[model samples]
Target: MTLGRSAGGVRLQDVADLAGVSMKTVSNVVHDYEHVSEAMRDKVQAAIDALGYRPNLTARRLATGKTGMIALAIPEIDQFYFAELGRHIGEEAARYGYRILVEQTLNDVEAERAVIRDRDEGLVDGVIFQPARIDTLEIARLRPGTPLVLLGEAARPVNTDHVMIDNTRAARDGVEMLLGRGRRRIAFLATVHGDITESTHLRLLGYQEALLAAGVGLDAHLVLQSEGFGFEDGVRAISSAIAAGVEFDAVLCRDDLFAMAALRGLEIAGRRVPEDVAVLGWDDTAVARYSTPALSSVSPDKQALASAAFALLEDRMQGYDGSGRHEIVAHSIIERATT
Candidate 1:
């Protein structure tokens, strides 16, 4: 069909004609299918730009039954972690010839189910999920062909790709580094969530491993839990712990914002950073480096994780039978002024 021309509208045929390639070749380029010559890709892209031949995504879904969008099921991005993940995921999806539809669960199970519902309703082609609930019963109803990828622990369904950090080692390494710097009394910091969330559970596991290695008995008295991950929330957590007469020579937080909060709180509590008590945190965010005394932290590369999630999910969408894949990005300690 002619469909329509430029300054008005253009059809897929126009793109094919201008590029001197078959309609199937144009389709392959649009879908980013490999084996298309670079010359063909260049010609098709130029034609797409020149002819203003925007593929009607809705119409394409009706014709092919494929939504050219990816759904990202994330917990609320009020903190840096998910925000950064979202940014990188969107960029990665763009590279894979897909768009992103973001859904936030606020850590609510019902909300998470709703995200799945929206996906089943043709809202997206696949899902990259950071699940707050790892229980089997919850994901039992996930629609087949949804091409889901899991991040963090309790990765379920057993038939999808997953990417996770070594949460235990991240914590263990953070603590031992502090001890190595002559800070003996160390504590792990994290925002306490309901027992279901793996983030809190795994980070604590890693932190405890380090304490055991250092011959420091795990002190429940020194564990400081926050209700949130904001910088101010971190400050409040540490401040309250100190006011209650808790004694610790070092604070290891689950994230950079929390680490900075610990530093701020410690200063207010009349402690000198690295001088009196060193502080370390997971997630080497930019703020970690720019803090008053550059915060030492674990470089989790959340952006890289997000990028990988979308890339693999897109592969599944394209009919690749890669099997239920799992990937773990290596992490390193970012030593700074704090420890």
Candidate 2:
């Protein structure tokens, strides 16, 4: 005299049997499909709780060709903008009933390739590729027939889907803000020059355009290009520029972290912000809101970018055979005492 089955394994059938529902209905509930009636779903969920059942994500993926998991690839997690973006993206994916996998590439070419290849070989359902080095082999691995969304960074030829803020416009507006405050001798602190990605070129173009419109010449001396994007690099760039006796009325950093190092260097030299030289940075991170004088920078809606990324990726996974799409999120400048 025993019951029909024991609930030790917590399989789909356990919930189905206990709830007296079809396995398909159970699948729909677990997958968060829209069609399952609330009353029926409630019964299934109650049984699932009683049995402590967990959906077999692997098997479900096998049957439906979906893992309910997506990947995000980036250079590092320390940068405030990237870190903030990562957090928002995670929340957005969870909102859509998807799990996230993160891959750190350290901005190296080979490491980026390895991660993309791993994702392509069944490790993940789709990816949000943030290209560090867009080489052919790497591009080939990430060229998504599966869902793929590109994040903001350097640019590459788009035969794929992407979502990002208007980086060029953001930069241009930052420079224009500085100019509007009656600062003409403005400097552009770049992490790199002549890069294939249009991020650098476009932002620089904005700087030039703004300068020319204001009757200011684009001086090569004011362009401080760093080999890397880091605090120490910023320190070195400022120190080197000072040694070369380059003169400028203001410094605009590509990122706020670099702006910090620039500010530090200037402070040690007894120069007051906006009094001796005005300073501006991009990507309004936590540092921007709480720095010494508080930083004034533009904020690109990271959550909007994330939402766009996942939506497009999910569509692609559902066999979306559409052309590549791109989204340029709106950005607004935040004014603080530093400006």
lDDT of 1 at 321: 77
| TM-score, cand. 1 | 0.88
lDDT of 2 by residue, 221-270 (tens): 88887867678888778767877888877888878887888888788777
Model 2: which residue pairs collide? none
Which residue pairs come into collision in candidate 1?
none
The residue-by-residue lDDT of candidate 1 on 1-339, one tens digit each, is 332322346777789899898888887877677899998899899999997777777666766888788888888876666787788888888877778888888878778777665565667888888878645455755655577888877655556688988888778777777877787777777646434677677888878888787787878978877776567777887888888888888888877777877888888988998888888877777688778888888888777797778778767877887557888887889999988
* True lDDT of residue 143, candidate 1: 53
Candidate 1 total steric clashes = 0
Which residue runs does candidate 2 get wrong by more than 4 Å? Answer: 1-8, 17-23, 49-51, 135-142, 191-198
lDDT of each: 0.77, 0.77
Q: Please report, as a residue range, the 10-residue window in candidate 2 with the lowest summed lDDT.
A: 1-10
